[model samples]
Target: MPRWKTNLIVLWFGQFMATSGMSMIIPFLPSYIQELGITDPDEVAIWTSIVFAGNFLTAFLFQPLWGKLGDRYGRKIMILRSGFGMSIVVALMGFATNTWQLLILRLLNGTISGYIPASTSLVSTNTPREHIGFAMGIMQSGAVAGTILGPFIGGLLANFVPFQTIFFITGGLLCIASLLVLFLVKEKFDKKKAAKTPNISVLQGFQDLRKVPQIPALFSVTFIIQFSLLSVMPLMAIFVQGMHGNSEWLAFYVGLVSSITGFSNMIASPLLGKLSDRIGSEKILFIALLGAALTSFPQAFVNNVWQLLILRFFMGIFIGGLLPSVNSLLRKFIPEGMESRAYGFNTSALALGNMLGPITGGFISGFITIPGLFIMSSVLLTFNMLWVQKTLITRKR
Candidate 1:
């Protein structure tokens, strides 16, 4: 195998470990907070959102700073910084004596975490253009796989271990992941060249990125894609209940229906990515969006769990291609030396979307219905497809 491919494999494992470590902690977070002594139901609810989102709030501000550093220092160093830093911060969460300590630690965790984005940036910079799609697709699959498995493993571990012990185990896994990257990944960074390169402030960097014709459009794609997809999450269980009503195995069915998307997503991402490389990312993106939009509309109208499950599975196949395609296009549009910064900003947009999606879904469900949320998502995606065609396609024409 080529050196870049070897590096890709190692980073894939690292991404999986990192994502798994993160997810494993998430299931136990609410319980951890309760254990910290907050008993008021309202206070617990409030702290839960604060603790969950605190990391993203800080990460939103810090990602560009780290990205700039990555551009100047080295992408590998950025990955190490995030991996090691997050490992220690997460481990420290186990030692928190109060909600305040835990909240602060979570904030620190977000500020330090950027391993996956750094890895993605590194792969984009190193991999050949012809194979970038395949590389990105495979990278995304690692992340998806981690997401799918992490919760199950975490739930199982939670049954047998103390919550604090789970945090320590998660931290250890992350530390090991960083060590793997340290030994296995190779980057031909030029210290002398980086030294000579002028330092660009984060705001100025965004200004520079804005000057690129394709960037704003590309960033919008990231934001909208995340927003539309995650909008379904806040009410997925409730929607399932509405369709199937109460049952002895409603939780099992809900989990199965929800997880089926990840299963199909894992299978389809790399295949579609290779297909995109053969035809074009633009063509694949267009088809994927159209398919997602079409499939999503029927979900709002499903009469039973089976219909919903089948539609969601198909939706997953289409959604799988979106991010890898978007990332691949970013690689094409971003100036050669600034891949980290571009991805950093893109990551922030993604975090923002994640923050907003559930909020938007909750709002829609309040005013209309859960099914209406699906229609709203479909409309947003359809509009995004048209926007892409106009900005990226017709402009070239």
Candidate 2:
């Protein structure tokens, strides 16, 4: 491989290791909660919601702070902090005696959300401008592939392995990733520019947040899509767990669904992004946002795993493109010097949804049947789509 390819791979692997560990728990949370001795429906719902929301609440609170630190120090340190912090917290997840304990660890995990943003900034900054789409697409695949692979790995592990065991495996993977980044990847900071690093300000992060007029609207668009996807997300394991199958099947089905989505997404995101280069990110984003909204409704109505997987597969096509498009558009808005900080703000918005998606999904799932949660997700997403239509897609800049 060429030097750039080698660097990208190291960063990609690091991101994959970090993100995959975090994602493994998503489909297995309900099962983990079940092991905690909460059997009652209402209590399960509450505990699940708490576990789901804990990550987001922390992520939202801490993302901007991490973003500022990354700006002053370096992207390299931020990535290291996130990986090592998460490795510790996630490994401790195996020790949780109850839902509250697990929630605490997940909250701690959320505080380290800068890994993805930092990695993305590194790619966007270093990549030859012309090959950015292909490069980012390749880099992003690790996260998407991890999401796809995590549930399956998590599910299979959960069968004979304890829910706590999942943590050790994920923690090990992440630690390996962190080590790779520290020793193998090099950060070539501009020493000439370092002396003048601006005032170490979180406030300046906001200036880039506003430097582009469309970001606020674009941010909302992203939140809606993620919110829709996650609304049904929390209940996947719960739904599968209740079916007549054993734990092995739970791993198979949950992993199957997530894997298929990831597999399809891996193909679709870059294709959509490349197409966006031809049409426009605005058009692809708006249309795909609507596609995700429409796709969400059917997932709620499906009766079995097969049906759900089919819907999720198609949903991946629309879902995969949103993040890349969001990033590609930001590359347009961000001040030349502030790619990492700008992504930090954009990431905060997505992290808001990721953090909130589960909590909110848990809440909806607690009150409603698993399928009903999809309707709620679809409704919220539809509102976001309509909001985009009203505020952005149609408006002339």
Model 1 weakest 10-residue run by lDDT = 22-31
The deviation in Å at residue 88 for candidate 1 is 2.3
Candidate 2 per-residue lDDT, tens place, 1-397, comes to: 5556666889888777876787787666766788788988677766776787677778877877876766667778888898888888889989999877888888888887678888888777766666566566666677777766677777777777778878998888888888988887777656457557665577756865775677777777767766667665656766666653565576668777766778777788778877877777777777777887788788766666788788888877777777777777777667766777777877777778876777777776656877887788778877876776776667745
lDDT (tens digit, per residue) of candidate 1 on 4-87:
999989998888877666555444555567789998754654565566556667777888888888888889999999999988
> Each candidate's lDDT (Cα)?
0.80, 0.75
Please report, as a residue range, the 10-residue window in candidate 2 with the lowest summed lDDT.
239-248
The alpha-carbon lDDT assigned to residue 46 of candidate 1 equals 52
Q: Which regions of candidate 1 are displaced past 4 Å?
A: 25-50, 95-102, 156-163, 234-257, 301-308, 362-364
TM-score of 2: 0.91
Off by over 4 Å in 2: 241-248, 366-368, 386-397
